[model samples]
Target: MIKIISCILLVFASTYSFACKDPLYKDKYQITNFSGYSDVIVARIITSKHNDDEMYSPLMSFDAAVLEKIKGALTPNQVIHVSAKIEDPRAACPLYFKENSTYLLLLERQEGELQISRFSFPIESNNEHFSSYLSQVKSGINIH
Candidate 1:
């Protein structure tokens, strides 16, 4: 009887754990007005003429593909929101990039443009089990 009760309790705990999880990278980070998506290494952005500060207000580079999706719509010196995954808390210091940092990029298109928009960071999935999480988010978007 005790063994049977223990099994039932274990099943209940597992079900509850699964139910509480968030999908869609929603809990991870999100971006709005995200222009495009690109798969690139982190080193490129660090080496480029556009460092953290030059980008302005909130300074940081994002995935090339996401930037491309919205670049055409921005005007020179305009503020835009950028949403990105916060891999390192120290990367955007003084003004810490929000936790679970998915949002939007508000940027100013400048002359002699460094094309920082073209930069990207490779998505690292080895650390987290994100397959079901991403699928759930995708489904939520479709529903809307």
Candidate 2:
């Protein structure tokens, strides 16, 4: 009876999933962190390519037209390419992006290319506070 109960407890504990992150809100730390990004831009995803070869996690590649350049060397109307790996839905932060979706992304320059790492969170274009975050970062008055 003890072994059976322990097994059941282990199964339940191992199956517990943490809630995913909500990209709508940015605290003081988030604002500061976004400011440190190499490039911060608001762009509309013109195209998206999905790759599922890496097992459960799905990879997404995007080509977006730069609409606003809050910070960075990106020019207006330029096509910025970015890619993200949508992790398991049960993970704390699984980023989902769609073609034609607008997002405020923190892009880092790597090897002469812009890339989005697994830890980056792309804010939705519709987020009301998107502008606020940009302003804070741009003015360098964001929370420390």
Candidate 3:
């Protein structure tokens, strides 16, 4: 029992220790052509799985359901896959989405698949910061 508890603690500590405390980019670009940049959606992360087998490096896979389509042709309730590297918070660009949480995501298309944009990070749907972006997306205002 003691060993199991210790192992759990260690794993928890390791994951938290990798959390990034700062945004990858501080500037927000006015999204002139929304579709040209990426597809914007309000989605809930259904599951997040960690995989380190692709490149022998840690990465997270997020399977999400599109709750609302702010822009682009994505159908609501559609599932999408997104991946992000597991690295120190300061060095990682792709924002990690928590399982079961809804987020305003700006997704770019890569190799025929939708992906987290190389621009800004994901914002929780209920977060104060999400409204501004949501409004911008709805209004067709350039801002990601």
Candidate 4:
């Protein structure tokens, strides 16, 4: 009887699913840590398009003009390309890059190219909150 009850409880527990909460907000220390972890730049999206090719389907790419190099060695006005996954309804954090919008991007360099993800530290270029974080980066604060 004890073994049968334990098996039934285990079966029910295995079938149960839990919903995950979205973690969209980054705290000050986390934002500051991104400056040290990835190449940080202020850039304007020159163009963006969804990849429709079957080989690269489900991806979106953006061509951006680097407005300023906050932490990285990127040259001002240089055109850089970045890519991310399309907005997934099942994803907790869906990142979308809009054309003509400016952003302060934390980019991860991969195989000689830059990429951004929903987990990447991306903030609007005009957001006032960024000033405080940028100041810390500029001051060479210890990110760890």
Q: Write the per-residue lDDT of candidate 3 for residues 46-84, one digit (tens) a residue.
A: 987755554323336689999997777788989888765
Listed in order, each prediction's TM-score against the native is 0.23, 0.72, 0.62, 0.62
RMSD of 1: 14.1
lDDT of 3: 0.67
Q: List per-prediction Cα lDDT, in the order shown.
A: 0.33, 0.67, 0.67, 0.65
Candidate 3 lDDT score at position 46:
93
lDDT tens readout by residue for model 4, 1-144:
999999999888765532223444443624535543456777899888765663323336789999888666689989988877334434343455678888777777767677776665566656666666555555553432
For all candidates, the clash counts are 22, 0, 4, 0
Clashing pairs in 3: 20-89, 30-142, 31-142, 31-143
Selected candidate, larger TM-score, 1 vs 3: 3
Ten-residue stretch with the least lDDT total in model 1: 39-48
Candidates 1 and 4 compared: the better one by lDDT is: 4
Off by over 4 Å in 1: 1-59, 66-123
- Greater TM-score among 1 and 2 belongs to 2
Can you give the lDDT of residue 50 in candidate 4? 67
Candidate 4 TM-score, true structure as reference:
0.62
Q: Give the TM-score of candidate 2.
A: 0.72
How far residue 39's Cα lies from its native spot in candidate 3, in Å, is 1.2
Question: Per-residue CA lDDT of candidate 1, range 44-143, in tens?
Answer: 1211112454323333433222322223444433333333332333332212232332323223334423222312321233325334333333343342
Give the per-residue Cα lDDT of candidate 2 at 134.
60
